[model samples]
Target: MRRVQRVPLDEAARQYLCERQQYARRLLAEDRLRAARFWKDMRETAVFTPVLTALEQMAGPRRRCMYCLDSRGSDVEHFRPKASYPHRMCSWRNLLLCCSDCGRKKGDRFPLDDQGLPLLLDPSADEPWEHLDFDPETGNLTPRFDPTGASSPRGEETVRMLELDQREELALGYQTTYKRLKRELEVALSAGPLDPSALRERLEEADDHGLLPWCLRYGGSTLAPFSTLRQEHPAVWAALSEAV
Candidate 1:
């Protein structure tokens, strides 16, 4: 998954959320809160609608799921399950946009490390490429392995929890996006040295699944067309990388 750029909510919405969070925290402290029911009721209110809109804006034009980036982000997901962390129930950073499938699969299951840190990747907060690696051949995401051959525990847990490597449709969508990105580079390279700005624009437009960062900066950089560009024209490669 690509890193999501979190957008700020309006002052009114932020105040509303803060007030609601205080209410939740109070009830939770008293052991009187039913997290699911409380959130469900608040979700239908006018005040909460703005939060969803802001999340959609963060997901970009396609409104893709923050986790998979494939389906429309229809649900406002709690990064830390509200039932478990009621104090963060209405915190802006604790919310994310997710597809119905992912929402269902993830439910309220949140795993944590020994120190009580989240084992899952927070796309808005974490750099995905640092933990997750793309496999162009299978179009499946795997935990990134370090030079020491140790895989990222967070990435492994995230993939397993979200079933990132098992979804056939998700894999296909990633493959299609990868191919499109590859083609853009191939076409640019074939046309002989072209303006880096134009090429960067084309690549960004074609990067529907947000694979440009992976293709341009990470593992995909070592693959064909991209590697060729880097080798043959280091200056253009630097420009393209800087732009993306």
Candidate 2:
């Protein structure tokens, strides 16, 4: 999961949402006819436009599933499943853009922890790499280990629920990105005289899975090339560390 940039809704869309919200409120208040009219408009626009807009914001050269950040993100997903959380069916924060594979894997499973926090990370609200770690060599995601050696429960649950480790296709996708990133870094290191800024920009361009954060901040500290960079090139390591 990565940081999802939330696009502001246009004025016309905002007005439409206001009208729809009022309609839902009226329906909740027992105005059946009015509520139905509002629901109809809400469904039309909510199902029709917002999803399209979400896709527009989510896709780019590094398009990915909003939830798993593994597969190709292909469609808009409701953060609150329409069937289970119908009241939020049209809410903005309740919607996410995702790939068909993630959509299928997620289905309607929205588990909550004892503290009422969602087990899954909302990429829009949280950075997923914080709780998760990726092994580029294996292309399997694992729960982040704390200083105490205990794994993050949230990350573990998410990996298991989405089968982030077991999914062969997703693993291959990550592996491809991982290999590309490693190659880029290795070239930077071997070039004898490295320009840190230019190298950082190049690495940023190559990063597709938002793995840079996990690499520089977490993955870099222990893992191979990152570790080698950390020990050999302190300035480059520091710059990359802050870049993420």
Best model number under lDDT: 1
Model 2 residue 107 CA deviation (Å) reads 1.1
Worst 10 residues of 2 by lDDT: 31-40
Off by over 4 Å in 1: none
In angstroms, how far off is 223's CA in candidate 1? 0.7
Alpha-carbon deviation at 142 in model 2, angstroms:
1.7
Q: Which candidate is the best by TM-score?
A: 1
- Per-residue alpha-carbon lDDT of candidate 2 for residues 6-72, written as tens digits (9 for 90 to 100): 7777767666656665666566567354433444565565445754565556555556778766667
Residue 47 alpha-carbon offset, candidate 1, angstroms: 1.4
Give the alpha carbon lDDT tens digit for every residue of 1-244 in model 1: 8888888899999999999989988888798899889999999999888899999899998999999998999999999988778889999999999999998888889999999999989999998988998898888988899899999999999999999999999999999999998998899889876888899889888887878888878888898988898889899898888776
TM-score of each: 0.97, 0.85
For candidate 1, what is the total of clashing residue pairs? 0
